[model samples]
Target: MVLSSSLSHLALLVSLSANNVLAAPRPSSPMSLSMNLKRRVPEARSADDISAWAANNKLALEAKYGNTKSIAKRSSGQNLIVNQKADSSFFGSLAVGTPPVAYDVILDTGSADLWLASSDCADSACDGVPTFKASDSSTFQNKSTEFSITYGSGAAAGSLGEDVVQMAGFSVSNQIFGVCDQVTDNLLNSPVSGLLGLAFQTIASSGASPLWQTLASSNAWDQPLMAFQLTRYNNDSKATDLEPGGTFTMGATNTSLYTGDIDYNDIPDNDESYWLQTVSSITSQANSISISSGSSALAAIDTGTTLIGGPADAVAEIYSNIPDAEAGTGQLEGYYIYPCSTTVNVTMAFGGKSWAISNADFQAEQLNSNTCMGAFFSLETGSNAPAWIVGDTFLKNVYSVFRYNPASVGFAQLSSEALAMNGVNGASTPSATIGSAAATVSATAGTRDANSAVALFHSSPSTTGPIISLLAITMTMFISLRLV
Candidate 1:
């Protein structure tokens, strides 16, 4: 989730020589810190699994608006035999402290802050996950500032600290981050220690410079930019939880991962909290209906989110153009379902250059013989919320770049090898045995108990104030399965 805040500027100071002559700046080089990402795949064997996933997301949304609720567990005893690959997240390794204790963290572009589970974290969510032992680090500095961050799904609260953080051969000294002693079940899941936020420092809940910003301000990169090339499994049965997930590069773009020129889109000056941009239009070729248009159709390009989300009205408009696209009810209230055979060729434009979404990425899961879930969901709408949230559903189609100086997001067509691996050229239709799955849904009716409220408190020797509000509207994590 992205939080909004007053934007802050970063200034670089140049020092002069003893002769009182200004020293020449170093020549820019094409140096890059690159690494491979690992994907986490969770299998969903039945419709109940899919419903539970969607329900979890709904609960998170409610919690974000101070309406935390208990999720109702609904089971439609329909045995839908399918091997649905629910690839949930991608993470990579980074180290902290003097000896560099390694931990796997999700490279998130949506939020700002770097946090890891502490050895004192007794929360069940921290079980089986690695924790950071501050005593082991010689350069660790406990700021004694109590901090808490509320996510759409979960929350974490602990004290702030500064340490040496290393990633992909690049080390950032005296980087301020969170050392969580308390966390929710969703905070530090297995195989994922924490998150490395790549967004700006303005949206940081801890009120500290993010890891990327600290590195950039220290001149750790040849270029002040980051690029990503996310990989897809296409529902490969042999794929494991730690499958190859493409590349993550800092400083420069990888030409081999993409083709043609990169299209750079400007981020609005006022909306620099997240990597937000104006989406010119969203159109569906199947029904020839313009689902959304105009300058107000803004979107946040986030890597932390799994699927695409839009305003309820825009989501309904999108499904209106697809034949037999029915709105989901019951446990899947905020989702949409359509005929499995329907070809949903959806394309979106940023800066008037349209990018096509692969059919494999458009549909989520096959609920029954003829019905399948759509990847796009309805998010809470308001004056502060972005109209759309663009996640992996759209990002996997292009080579994405996040620049810092000018603060622009860039996209390029995937290379031939990348496209072939994603099944873009000749993707197969979803295959499923639909006789057992429920084909019809009733009106939305379910009881929800509010989740735990976000905890905020200040302790002794605190260096920062308590978090007063969220920085931006962030979508909860979404997990789903589908036959391919």
Candidate 2:
């Protein structure tokens, strides 16, 4: 599914447990906790819609920040390869509560707040998914705090609770998260049960301490850093399979994941919302045009979003460079559609490094027999939207590191192993037209992030706990259309 914004709610649950939380997960050697992420795409929603949704988020951020310039830098520990679906969102599993009930959650970097379906939730939104039964846990505690968090795309209302949450082998005890009794239907239909936000705490909707902060406070990790290794396969074959695709590691950067030096850039502390950055230029090799003008403009590094987005003028200039490219049809206006055979090279300059987006990344999805949607889309009204919203479309091609100490974001070239898996290392291409070609590449080259945040933890067979099957939320709404 096309996961959207972050929102959370607190609810009362009657559960009992000791305040004694697990210090951290302990492994024999240097170990990384990993989870396989799955992807879901709405059959009714076209790729155009997905790209436009990302653009909408850019506009929403503009509305929230106005002209403000504030941002911060920030982990290393464990690693796990995650799975991703073609043209959609990525998800993985984490165990929560005393017994460690497993829940599937969509990891998001665009917003702050961790929420899941409440066991007491009688609403239709919680139907058929995993729920946290507070009564069943020995460590569950009610915060008595009520919250109503609204997002650009969706909302959740409930109360707060404290419990032990585990991702892979990493564990955080007495951790607080939203127990949502009410949520939007789009989120309900999503394969995930809840959402976990990775953005700064200043933007947390529930006014609660963020989960990453909790883990960072503990001396479990070597450093306050996190890395993602998203693997996009050649087709939809891995979409339903619980197979390993990539890795998400915490505490330490896996030297095996990327090649060359990991370049970093500071996120101006003033831009404290998303991991926002200023881009010097955007280049399209097809036309040899430097579309970026004016001073460096802001861009958000969002993992929750599936497509790349920017101002209409900039997006248009990008499409103009491609042969037989045109605006999307009807309600999909503003989105670009191009011949499936389109080949283009686009690069964005940031932190003094020019990161090139492979041609494969631009061929978003096949619309029909002849047309395919481009990953780059135009924000509805660019006057307020950030100059760019860099989503998974581009991030998947690079190894990304979000550092907290200096409050900066970094990117490095994907290793040979990553390039081969993502179809960037000169993977074989079919000779058929855009339709057959896209289907071939989309199946193999779809990019997904294995976002890992690992902390050390020691567990006995008895204390290992059960895996909770809770569902995570996918915020489909970026912002209210009225804001657009």
Candidate 3:
């Protein structure tokens, strides 16, 4: 089913225990506490952990994503790898997990809900795809509700069951999550177990209960929204072979996250689906670039994106910036291709200044000793599928933070200093083509204090809470732990 953003108010029923809240299950044993209660958040985790995890773990990357800084970092992705023993969260952080199954999740950031696809699905797509057998989990119970979730490129079909779900860094006892009976079609059937929708901010379906409202009104986390820093991925490598992307932080930054200037864009009370934004500017490809990490290119970005759309001509143009570049390849779609050995300096202009792609991002997945690929590319094919998705490929290059501001709407971009301080790492995932040089943004460097990250919490009287950074958003607030 094409999950409509409006389905929440239709039939969803979010019943909370504390009495004054939004939505699910009880913790398994005495050791597990509902995330709705309280738990200790990590304060000293490091990039070193991320590097070890990504390189060593099968599906994990060395990068960890988080909004917390006092200690560590991890590569947070938009999906999950569910296991029978996977921890669940219903309220607080006491029920978090360890190793690969910890609560740190890569969420849709754009959608809401803190659901896990349980293992009860009776479909073939469930074969290799990870599943959470609630019956065997010992902490499982049926909510008597059937459920299904959809994404631009994927979908999870299952039943709405109750269990203790692991969260941010702990657990949420008696949480409500999707127990999939049908396997997620598409590439998700291979590795990704399920999706953690971070958009809606609530576990919505028939009722308009966003994950954010449930948490905030429930007084769960200190904040509602989770912070992210996708170090960047090299699609040049196989998709299934994803690396530790970045750090999903919560509450703080590391010795590295400098305190910088922040710009916030407020979300309207009536509509959250419309990530509401004015046209920042039109790309050279004639595409309007609103620039949102939370908003997937496929769903929110394109007006004429019959297929995945992007800064069309800008892609070819940027590839040319790399010295001694080549033309393009693959679908003959004009995407820039290059050798992994090349050190390309790339930048994105926004506020009159350019954000640089760190050297790490510029590097390709290193296919063999001679071949490499570029990070940026147009997902458009001659097909009708909305194959579009503006992922870390471009975001990692800029300080593309999304937050709310008073008197403003939706989200806001970063300040000149906030962005200038963030530097580019490696060359863009190797590209197959090189077009023209065109114009570039000024490259004046700036720095922000480590403690000054753009915080997304709630305000009073506004019905929002302090953890999420706004009027109580939803779950999908996952941060992976890595050894970067």
Candidate 4:
């Protein structure tokens, strides 16, 4: 999740070039390196599976919203990849320190601060998880800066340190990051080891520089650019969960991965960290809502978030026009639900261009033979919070670029390969094997935060709403379902 350090400081990082001048753009080689990505679909089939995800999702929401009030008072926060499993998440592996100890990390753009569980950590969250042992690495250096960060899901305390972090063919030496000595159980069960934040340093909870910035400023590449081509998976099946077709490029945009021109949009001056943009309108065949013309709402193009969340009134309006769409239940009480047969058609406007979402992405989950969860969720932060947190649900349909020099984000139609395998289910046939070649790698993605307000939902009949904290909701309601 993103934590803004200076909420009112609306400016990009100063360019680190001669005389405050920018370096010459690299010619021909826009994206110098490319690595494949993997998709991780949540196991939410049975009653036990639903209960487990609900508990985990609660922790994620807590971390996402719980620390906002205290974040400013705290001096440190980790670049974390939380452990809750949503319907879709993507991650990649990298090596750290000398001799290269391998660890899978989320390439997140939501927040900045690199962190990992350390050998010293024995918290419930670190149980049975891989730890980064500083002593084992010859080049490891302990800065001994005590650090701590709280998430809605859990909390962590550790020390700051430096080491060499390598991905694909690129490497960054003396990379500053956190080593957790203690963490809540919510983080211990993550599918990946840590997070490598890609957003600007302005939003870093610890005020640390992001991995992309360090690599861009260093001699590693000629330009400060990164691009992503996310792949999709079939929610109905789990055979291709480890498929390795999605690609991430550093240094330049991969022309081969996109069709048509890459339309760029300037990051608004008022936004502090996230690659945020003001939405002009949200349109569908049934209706069109002028978001920007009315109340002026901003949407963060976040790779870390899982769903499209916004103010309850706005989200409710979007689903209200859909035929047979209804309110959800249990953990998703505030969210929308619809018949599985209904196909959703929605588009978001930015930079005067309309980007359409695929019907394949609208299916959040098959709740039963009649009902399915809508892809969109409600945000309790009201209209003041970012109007939308557009995640993979919309990103998989477009090839995106995050550029630093000009402080802009770009988007283009997905290439034929990406389009052929676009939607909740992409590949018709599953591959039998996955290779572990360093250059050709695969990743696992996940979402730690639940999109809706946790407090609004009622716990099981036997329990008292499962309210665990003072900040959480205490209202109770009972569902007749056996395990809901």
Candidate 5:
């Protein structure tokens, strides 16, 4: 190969210039060194193998013994058949006087409290709908169970009762659930009759097991876990809600849902509720989470929250990590941003392993200036303290499932084939393996606060809902789950 005389001279000059920059007698500017140092760090994951490994291992845990546990043996599971549906399938409603007015219910793992449209409630808080009346339902069995859940914005108080729940192609006989009697002014849309607490346990009663917990303990099915998903209602008023936009499953993952490799963790609690993990390490910044399914917030990975809550500084730091994320002035919530040409890489560490957000997970809705907008979770700085919640923004990115045995942990992302849908078994094969999640939630991804919320959690979600204080008095940080 031959090069022109000018080209050769230019190349020689560039080489000499670079040598001078690197080998200068004195040190270069700190900013210049930082740029070079960042460039030198190894890539977080390999494009060739990471995806394949995640795809394979991605098929989607246990405990018992009070607040703590010891792995005694693999829990033999119940044998109930597992059936699943799409987000737009499972439907519910509030019946005032006439035939029950049907409404869709959002089953969330990110939260533990459950509530729905109530009949006795009346206020602007009730989103233009009929509340549930105890006298209307053919199946409302009053148990005199009192329930009250608080939130960052407000609270929802109710009672315990049983109802006829029709889903998963199977009817639950006298399914026990929470019936809201009073109303909170901030509740998004109302007529919310009652909430079905799928959690294995509830705090309403001292040392009381939840309805879902009772079912799991009884081994009503071959497995102890339940799987669910909520259809994204991308509007202020969701007309599609009156139709069907949610799903609840007993045994496996719906095939129509996005399929990937699954990672599993056993709940620290032996029952289906109380999803807990060991914080491999903790500091004063952000907790590292091994949420292998997709990138969300550290908060959503938890099951003890109703709304996403966290430290203000950390939220600001997270937003600042991305270029062009403006500071929140008055009402504007800060968000991450990147140039159209820039590839955004977000990742978290769980169970001593680090995972990156896949390309498909990077789907974005471009706003302007060739920028994009999306949030894995809305963790604003609560006036109280720093807490991270994995809400809808977080959970929706991954297919979350609960596991009851073998390890007594919550499982996510099932691989069952014969999953039911539209109230029908629409598949050919039965489920092979149920997945588990990291029982150890770490704080490696970021720093922690001087005062952090309780490291212990049972479950939580990212919508507007009543708050559950997972914070232990020892921790002194108030982390609340706001109900929707």
Candidate 6:
């Protein structure tokens, strides 16, 4: 049976031993820990595959909940041998329980709560992928409380549990997570064993402190922040399931991964669940067509989602500016199709700073010999829903930082190394003119030092610590919409 987000609040009892409790660490100075993300792309896929997957995913979500337009809720691939370059999904390694059994999970910033397949799961969806065996870990504590979460693509139901969870060399003791005995086929087809949500705990379906919140609140790091540098595979000639995905840094920002000053946009105190920021405008750089100017539409910067989504009217307006662009019909409904040869350069601004999206990223995938699908889709909207859901399509172009103390989202130009992997030139600059009007902010290059002082931790020292080696793992997974 499908479950709503409210179902996650069911009472759960966790038993913890005194020795299993982890002590927060106090460092001499602020430091950062880094983990390598591994990209997994199904063999030989196209834009049509992604479009169909996203459409079906949306239907499943709508069926579980009511129509998104009225509910006002906040919330792919083939095996051909051709040299196909499509959008890729990313996952990273983390260990849970005692004795440290490692599992690769999708590092998602869109949702809260962490869950893994259970060893006792006999569902077909849990076949092949690694499962967490509660019996194997001496530190594991079964809460025995049942829980379920419905995703855009599918759903999973399992029991709640607590254990020592480790990632990027740091461990959080008595971390609450889910052991899923049943999962949809959409998740079963992926290489990832489960998902690790990085959003705030308020929206967690499990109604427990998210792993990131637990670490930050316990002063596990010097600063209450996490940064991501997501890589691309569309340009890689030797792209595989194990390609170098990118970097996931905790505590502090990696100055080396980004260039210039970070343009930090404050997230309103009222909306702290997701890493949300107000989008000032969206301009099509090719013809300088702008939409949603002076609009207060909130945009969620999500790493887990593969494409960009916005309100129907706003998305329709943006696509109308493109020459010969047509709205998709039938299964391709809510999407726009344009010529594959067209260079779609879209720029999105937040806090008066506009970051241009690379043409390669804008053109999601080639739908046919002549037509291609755009990455941006018209998402169903509601009163509390964010107007735009910005995903990896726009994130891969910039260095994104999510801070919790003051609660803000920051973006900076990509470094030369990041640009090289994306096969793009220098950093994207702000457009001088948008549509028929002058730009709100003047075009000027700015810079901010990454080492600037922020909040520091004053807690007790921990046995485990934080960033260094980059290890890439190989796994294959089909692309699907993961919006929460």
Every model: Cα RMSD to truth = 18.4, 13.0, 18.2, 15.5, 21.7, 14.9
Candidate 6 per-residue C-alpha lDDT over 419-479 given as tens digits, one digit per residue, 9 for 90 to 100:
5654222121111110110001100111111222111111111101111121111111111
How much is 15 displaced in model 5, in angstroms?
61
Better of 3 and 4 by TM-score: 4
- The sequence of per-residue lDDT tens digits that candidate 3 reaches over residues 221-266 is 3323333343322222221122223333322222132234333344
Candidate 2 vs candidate 6: the lDDT winner is 6
Return model 4's CA RMSD, one decimal. Answer: 15.5
TM-score of each: 0.74, 0.73, 0.48, 0.73, 0.50, 0.75
Once superposed on the true structure, which residue ranges of model 2 sit more than 4 Å away at CA?
Answer: 1-30, 33-77, 189-191, 217-219, 234-243, 286-296, 380-387, 423-484
Q: For residues 1-484, could you state the per-residue lDDT of candidate 4 as single tens digits?
A: 0111321110100000000000123235332322222333444364333323433342343234323111011010001111112224454445567655655555566556778888887676565556788887887989879876654445567888887665434445566788888866544333345556677787666666666665554423344566666655544355234343355666556666787787778778745476777776787645886464433476667665555665667677888878899876665666676777877888877766788887766665565667666667665432333556666667767887777767777888888866664333332212111111111111111111123211111111122111111111110100000000
Question: Lowest summed-lDDT stretch of 10 residues in model 4?
Answer: 13-22
Q: Model 5, residue 445: displacement in angstroms?
A: 44
Candidate 5 per-residue lDDT, tens place, 1-484, comes to: 0111232222211111111100001112110000000001111222222222111111100000111222111122111111111111122321111222233232333334445546565555565544556676664777786766543333567786665433321223344555665655533322223333344353322123443444444543334565444323222121222222234434333333434444565433333333433222222113332321211222224322211223445444544555565542222233333454445454443343234443222322233446443333233322221134333333333445566554422323422331221122122212111122111111111111223211222111111221111111110001111121
- Arrange candidates by TM-score, descending: 6, 1, 4, 2, 5, 3
Ranking of all predicted structures according to lDDT, beginning with the best and ending with the worst: 1, 6, 2, 4, 5, 3
> What does candidate 1's lDDT look like per residue over 27-118, in tens digits?
23432322222232344335655655565554453333222111322111100011112334554555567654556565667667788888
User: Once model 6 is optimally superposed onto the true structure by TM-score, how far is the C-alpha of residue 475 displaced, in angstroms?
Assistant: 20
Clashes of each: 12, 82, 161, 18, 109, 4
**lDDT comparing candidate 5 with the true structure:** 0.31
Model 1 C-alpha lDDT versus the unseen true structure: 0.56
How does candidate 1 fare on TM-score? 0.74
Please give the TM-score that candidate 5 achieves against the real structure.
0.50
